[model samples]
Target: MIVTELRFENYRNLKNNTIVPAENVNVIYGENAQGKTNLIEAIWLFCGGHSFRGSKENEMIAFDNKYFRLGMNFFSGGREQSADIAFGQNRKQIWINGVERSSSSYLTEVFSAVVFSPEHLNLIKRGPNIRRRFIDAAICQHRIRYASLLSKYQQIINQRNALLKDIRKHSELKDTLAIWDDSLITVGAMIMKERYDYLKMLREPAKTYHHGISAEKETLDIEYQSTTKTDENDDFGTLTGKLRAAFDASQREDFYTGYTSVGPHRDDLDFKINGISVRRFGSQGQQRSTVLSLKLSEAELLYQKNEERPVILLDDVLSELDNSRQDFLLNKVEAYQVFVTCCEESNKVQLKNGKVFYIENGVVK
Candidate 1:
């Protein structure tokens, strides 16, 4: 998806203004905390997801302002369209082409983007939750229904955990535990299936991108470390049966822990390079390349499924890479519109062709 024009008002530290960017590789440069990433974030919000920086609505409003407003004009579906967002009164509202939408989730189908920042390195350095969230977010972009399924699965897990804790207090309510077990297996199995399939599709592309970035000296491998022990060959029915048995086997442990410990919620992704665990064995450069590969793979999958190139947002990532790696990243994304944030003009000199925006004290010059 190409954004031809983007406008922001009373948003974060940005002055009320708009920018028309080049269709390829727009570089946003400024001093630290001068709203370079803030500009990238304003565009990312249109993707119908929470801020990648994890900011709340009130935090996004400019100082002393009651609300924030953002607008975008873009090219998608063989035509030009527009979308607007306004946040105030403890609520966020969305409108597409002048028609109001009840929720921002509807914009997921209209705009697509893949974002990379220094913090994303946590995908490998952090715990399983980070990797789990990365996979789930990727799946939700194309399979909108998966979002609801995930929500339902979390709710079931929460209820089951609470019931497990209660059963400890009164053993008589133990039999009622079977009710949540049945529902958990039913919903949890589907969650595992979706995660399995999405990882299967993601593995090959990620490896290919990693191979290129690593100069073909390394091999990348991605595997779903399911708590159920299900594999790619397992059918949905088989997944449910295995998950049911797993829950039954883990009952003693679950009861002792006061939580449902065996299901998709406990699953994770394992990344390996050259037969070594990237998390524990890989160098800093290797870790960065692996994350970059996964992100590019995410972008490729979005295009393959949606038939539209997603906007690429790079937040102060180029300065952290070597010259060769930087060139590889820029070349790989040349076919789509990109917005990169950096604190130095030298990073802006890397792109062969692109428009540059300089910002100081929240104003783009």
Candidate 2:
């Protein structure tokens, strides 16, 4: 997918702007706090239906404005499409191809984007929630059904936790607990199976990409750490059995802690190099390379599954890598349309064919 043009109004620092990105590599450069990152954020929001910076729709409006708008034109699978989104304190709407639509439906037809920022290292060093989010976000775009399943699973988990918190006092809540448990097991088991399958598909590509980027000096391994005994080959029945046993074993602890602990919600992804845990032992460079590999792997995975490439968003990450690593990244992304943000003009690396837009204050000059 390629974004041909983007227009933003009262969004972040951009009061009103329109940009036509290069088909191959488009670079936006300026000093810190300029509107470079904001431009990319708008494109990402339109593609994924969420802000990469974790900002809310209302907060994304210009400081004093009460409303914001973002629109983009792109081509996917050889077809042209456009998406427009407007948000305010009390209302929000999305339009695709001149027709009103839900953001979820808009996302399915508009575009897909994969972003890499310096902060992505947190996926490896942080808690399970971050890693889970990484997986879910990628999977949600590729498999729409996964999003519905995840939403259902999260709701069931929340309800079950509430019951657990009160079960001990009521004693009569056991029956209620059973009801949520059944739903949890059903949805949780499916979630776990999908997660395990995604990890399995991600492992080989991530390892291969990491090895190539690292010059084969280090071996990369990805392991899915779940509470259940799930493998790449496990069926739903096996997963259900494992989850059932886990719930039974954790009943006492759950009642005491007022939360259910053993399920996909608590799962994590582990990264290792030469049999050593990267999160605990890898150096900063190693960690960055691991993240780079993981992201590139995601690009390849999306292409493999959908038969089309996803747009690449690089947020102030070029300056974070050495010349060799930067070249590797630049070379690998040549096949897809990329939007990059940099703090200095010098940080804007050379590209074969791309646009270099200068961003200042809140304007693109």
Candidate 3:
């Protein structure tokens, strides 16, 4: 998808203005705290997901303003389309193609995008929750139903945890734990299967990108660490059985801790560089490259599955990289419509051919 026009009003610190970006690459450069990243966040909201920066809906409005509105005109599914978001008085309204919608989820079917920011550079260095979130979000891009599945699994976990806590006090209620276990095993197994399959597909493209980024000096690997045994020969039924066994084994522990512990929620992804754990030993550059590779691979997989290219958003992620790495990034993104935000005017020179815009105090000049 390509965004042809973007309009904003009272959104963050950005001035009420409209921007028409180029079809290929657009480099947005400006000084620090001048709303370069805010522009990227605006486009990302069209994806129907929450702010990648984790800002609440009320927090997105400008100071002293009760609401914020973002609109975009884009080409998707072989036609021009438009979407709008208006948030105020603790209410959010969404519209696509001039038709009103009840929820933002409808926007995902119309627009898809992959975003990379400095916070993602810590994907390899951070805890397992971040890695799990990355994998889950990538899967949701293509598998829309997976999002509901995740919600169901989390609900099951919460209910099961409550039961376990009650079982701790009422010994007679222990028998009912079996029902929650059965539900957890069923939903948790499906979640694990989806996650495992996505990580498996992500491995190859991620490896190729990492190899090119490293100039073939190092190899990258991704392994899905599941709570249940996930051998290559295991199928969905086998996975279910293994999860059931795991839940049975952890029954006492679950009651003692008053939480469900053995499920997809406790799983993680392990990134390795040359057979060494990237989280424990990879350099800063390696961590950054690894995240970029995963992100690019996500875009590739989305295109492969849907036959539509998702917009790429790079939010101030080029500062710490060397010239060669920067060149690789620019070259790799040449095939897609990408928006790159930077703090230096010279960064726009790196893009051999593209549009350039400058932002000063929230106004694009």
After the best TM-score superposition of candidate 2, give how far the Cα of residue 142 lies from its true spot, in angstroms.
3.3
As a whole number from 0 to 100, the lDDT of residue 10 in candidate 2 is 97
Best by lDDT: 1
TM-scores across all candidates? 0.90, 0.85, 0.90
Q: For residue 127, what is the lDDT in candidate 2?
A: 91
TM-score of 2: 0.85
lDDT of each: 0.88, 0.82, 0.87
Write the residue-wise lDDT of candidate 2 on 139-258 in tens digits: 876687999999899899888888888787898878777788888889988888777778888889888888776777889998888876666577999888888888989999999999
lDDT of 3 by residue, 1-365 (tens): 89999999999999999999998888899999999989999999999999989999899999999999999999999999999999999999999999999999999889989999998876877788888888897888768799999999899888888888888789899888888788887888788878878877999999999888777887899988777666534788999999888888888788889988877898888899999988889888888888888888999999999899999999987777677777777665667899988888764437776788999999997
RMSD of model 2 against the true structure = 3.1
**How large is the C-alpha RMSD of every model relative to the true structure?**
2.5, 3.1, 2.5
In candidate 2, where is summed lDDT lowest over 10 consecutive residues?
344-353
Query: How well does model 1 score by local distance difference test?
Result: 0.88
Ten contiguous residues minimizing lDDT sum, candidate 3: 345-354
